[model samples]
Target: MIRLAVVGVGKMGLSHLSILGAHPQVRIEAVCDTSGYLLDVLGKYTGVTGYSDYEKMLERADLDAVVIATPTRAHATMVRAALERGLHVFCEKPLTLRSEDSEALARLAEERGLHCQVGYHNRFVAAFSEVKRLLELGAIGEVTHALAEAYGPVVLRPKGGTWRSRSAEGGGCLYDYAAHPLDLLAWYLGEPRAVGGTVMGRIFSADTEDEVYSTLFYPGGASAQLSVNWSDESFRKMTTRITLTGTAGRIVVDRQECQVYLRDTAVPPEGYHHGWNVRYTTELTPPVWFYLRGEEYSAEWAYFVDAVAGEPADGAAAGVNSFASAAVTDRVIEMLVADAAVPCGVAAASGTGASGAGVSGAAGAGPGSRGARKRAFWSLGKLRGE
Candidate 1:
């Protein structure tokens, strides 16, 4: 059995703990949290050792791996410590607030030859996975443009006291919410070379943005538009949707279904055909032992467990959610921040002349030219609390 520990028993952390604890091949060794009361409360139900300090737990518990669901800021430190002790790691998304730190941690995991996975659970969703397969099979045919969007009622009021409201801590909507669709876009389409037309707006959060809109330009002239909002009550919970437009057809995917529309008759994979076709996720996804929130959560954990056991089947697809993949998402976050730094007026003015050089210069100003804006955007919520 793989002896495992969990750090930071928050919402996501608890979810990981539930799935990992239920895995027959896993033994719940220990759990750590900054709150002694929380540790006490959880220890009673889990029947596992608990510690208030992560380092103490690491030193005392005999563990083969750790699942980290700490805040974005603490991810780098916790991951480094886990990797230093030769433990496999499963960390939540937005691996780190900065791209450089994410790159460094990725390198550390690679040098140690450890299996590290990020919490991009969407990739495991049947509909999303099917979309990836279709794209690989050229179902859409040279995707020219894509739209990725996520909306939910997460923070409708001012979250002045929460870490999520602080950019330095949780990275606002871009890292917390938009990361999902952005990661999906990067996975389907290649990494974006440049990002522009960025806008971050604070609809509810006192500091961090609750809505983010941007455009990503890929290498082969392909482009993607991203829109995310955590304050949209129209969605009962977080809902992500992707629409891809290609030379021959278009594909749309959401939690429940995958729909394809072909302009001209074309051969598609089995169960799909020309004209308009729809496939429900229930038909394409395999069964899972347990289901909570979504089957993807359990599916991802199953994959991680198999990866830890050195199972060849999972090893082949191990890199699907590896840290290296997350690092690319981090880079996109960086690009968005840089793009947001450019003044709205400047962007508008550059677009007026329609000169390539003028627009490029405006977009190239990046984070270096407007670091203060980025800082202010991240710190506004925290400052409100102070």
Candidate 2:
């Protein structure tokens, strides 16, 4: 069995614990958290040891790998400690608040010859995976533009203060929510060369932004737009959608389905037609041993475990969700943060009109002079932790 330890017993941490515990190839060697009460409760139920100190658990558990679900600020330190002790690591998204730290961790993992998977579970979603496959096969030809959006009711109110509202703790809709779509964009298209026309707004949260809008320009002239909001009550839960426009066709993907539209009568892949085709995720998603929010969660852990067990000393299999990939996503975040710093009027004056001129106004607002001023002021603040 692959012995494992889990740090941080918060929401995402507990989810990882449950899935890892259920895996037949894994043994829950220990769990760590600051809350004694939480440790006691989980220890009693899982029959696993618990510790208030992660270092103590690391010393005693004899673990082969660790899953880190701690707050953003704690990731670099915790991951460094675990890697130093020769443990494979599965860290949640935004591997670190900064790209340099993520690069350091990636290099460390390479030097140690250990598996390091970042938790961008959206990549494991069946439809998204299939979309990747199609893109690789040139299903839509050379991508010219793309759009990614995510919305949810995560921070509907400002009263219930949590770490998510504070930028220092990795709170904020940008890192916590928009990171998903941003990562998806980078994965589908190439890394962005430049970013401009950003809008970050606070609808409810006192400190963190509740909404984000940005435009990204890729090396090959392909461009992307990202829109995310955690204060949208219309979304019962988090919803992610991506649209890619290419030379030959276009593809659209949401949680439930992936739809493709071909501009010409070109031959298509199996289960797809030339004019228009739709594939439901229910028909495409693979089964997992356990399911929580989505099968992708369990699937990502399973992939990480397999990589830990089977990866060669060269660490080739680590590329799928590797820290390297997370670092690239971190770079995109860095660009977005930088773009948000520019004055809205300055961006528009430079011809980088919000999300491309005539495509969409900032945050669904019109091009009115008053709206432009509001958008400019809103985009000025730095993302808290950055």
Candidate 3:
């Protein structure tokens, strides 16, 4: 069994521990966290050893791999340390707040030939995975454009002044929530050429952003738009949807319920049924739909474990999530942070009227496009089961 060490006793870290501890292929060797009190409590409950310092834990634990769910700012340093020690790593999302740091880690992993999995959990969901498969088979027919939006009540920090309130910790609504939708978009299309957006912190006294609206442009006229906000008091919604109008057909995905509709042929014919039918083509049978099943996080963590076990990577069609997805996300955050002065509900001051034109260039180019090939290559590898 692979001996797994969990560094960070936060909510996510605990989730990782629970998930990993139960995996047949893994043994929860040790747990580390800055909070000695929390770790001690968890240790007593689980009968697992604990450490206050991650590095100290790493030094003493007989571990084959480490899962890093520390605060966002610490991701780079912690992941690098684990990888440098030749330990496979399963790190939480936004590998680093800065694109350069994330890129560096990606390079380091390549040089070390160590497995590194970044958390982009949605792609592992059965419904989202099915969408990935359909996109790979050209079910969406060369996606030309898409949109993703997520909205919910503002995030109030459980602690008043934690790292999550700082920009350095990647603590922004977009950074926290948009990553999923952005990753999904990249997976469906490709990376944007140039991305610009507005990020604002209007709803609360929080030090970071609460809202963002971004657009991404890809080659061959494909484009995508993403809007996210924590300022809304509306019903909580986490949607990774896409409306693809290809040369042949169209496909739409509602990630929350794993529902999809495809109109490949005609719209269910224009005629009515016999017998019990009262009307003719009144409903038109709608479009052919498919439903997906399974928990997203379970599938994602399971994949990470498999990758750590030497399974080939196949995340390309899914748009090299992990660090690559984080890169684009970072760019969006960059735009948001750069234009933070703009009110949460207002567009950038310029208001050129490109409809969130601030965030979209062309695909396969620009800083936002940083690791597309790596992402795509791994995706192809996955498709070939390499």
Ranking of candidates on TM-score, top first? 1, 2, 3
Candidate 2 deviant stretches above 4 angstroms: 311-318, 346-386
Model 2 agreement with the true structure over 22-73: per-residue lDDT tens digits:
9999999899999999988987887889999988888888989999998899
TM-score of 2: 0.88
Error of 2 at 216 (Å): 0.3
For each candidate, what TM-score against the reference?
0.89, 0.88, 0.75
Summed over model 1, clashes come to 1
Better of 1 and 2 by TM-score: 1
For model 1, residues 1-386, the per-residue Cα lDDT tens digits are: 99999898889988888888788999999988888888888878768899888888889999999999888999999999999999999999989987778889899999998999999999998899888888888877889999999999999776677677788897689889999999999899978877766899989877788999988888889999999999999999999999999987999999899999876655677877779999899997889898888999998999988888888644324468889899889888877876676564333344556553332233325442345344533442232222
Predictions in order: lDDT = 0.84, 0.84, 0.64
Q: Write the per-residue lDDT of candidate 3 for residues 1-386, one digit (tens) a residue.
A: 78899888787787777777767778999998888798779878988999988888889999989998888888888988888899988888867777767778878887888777777776665455656665667643567767777777656333347665666676767677777777777667765554443435445635766667766667788877777776676646454455556554555555543333444442222231211112211121122112122255555666666677776654532323555455555554454344343222223446547665442223455323434434443443342334
Q: Against the true structure, whose TM-score is highest? A: 1
